[model samples]
Target: MTVNLLYSITGLLIFFMGICGLMFHRSLVRQTLALNIAGAGIFLFLVAQAYKSDTVPPDPVPHGLVLTGIVIGASATALMLFLIGVHQSVSKSSNDEGERGS
Candidate 1:
């Protein structure tokens, strides 16, 4: 009923969905996307938990941590996508070379 409880439940659900996607999908890109989803859920949960008191201001530490996590997650996702592209290109080139040789 409370906002924090709702957010916590929603975050957990999203995180679980991501885990399921990661487990079921075969493609690296899909898995990467799932990982990002999970990270977002975690960040949301942290943000929700940061505000316990209605009168006092929300804690800045968790917000700062979430911001840092988002940056790192974005960087890691970009790196993963780039690597996946490289892998696909290399695989394609090798297949093409094989076909030509044969």
Candidate 2:
């Protein structure tokens, strides 16, 4: 098989793994990580598809879009993590105070 085909298979496997992770994980952090893993798979797939061994490289449009997507995903994930942290901290604090009063 060709290198490109091999890459495609690997990319597909990564994507499936991510999907399974997202489905099975219950905690917010785990789910988020799973999503990020899936995102990485997509990025890698795009990169693989755009690779041309003996040429100037595949089209620039997909690369540009992938770059933009990566930036957006990173920012969104940062915000998500912050929100999750805040939520967990607040919840734990409330639970602790309730226990102290009991």
Highest TM-score: give the candidate number.
1
lDDT of 1 by residue, 1-102 (tens): 899989988989999989999999999999999999999899989999888878989989999999999999999999999999999999999999999999
lDDT string, candidate 2, 1-102, tens digits: 878678767878887898999999999899889888888888777777877777575877768878997998899899999999999999999999999999
Prediction 1 TM-score vs. true: 0.94
| Lowest lDDT block of 10, candidate 2 | 53-62
RMSD of each: 1.0, 1.6
Candidate 1, residue 74: Cα displacement in angstroms equals 0.6
TM-score of 2: 0.86
Off by over 4 Å in 2: none
Q: What is the lDDT of residue 65 in candidate 2?
A: 78
How many angstroms is residue 62 displaced in model 2 relative to the true structure, after the best TM-score fit? 1.7
Q: Where is model 1 poorest over a 10-residue stretch in terms of lDDT? A: 44-53
- Give residue 80's lDDT in candidate 1 (0 to 100): 99
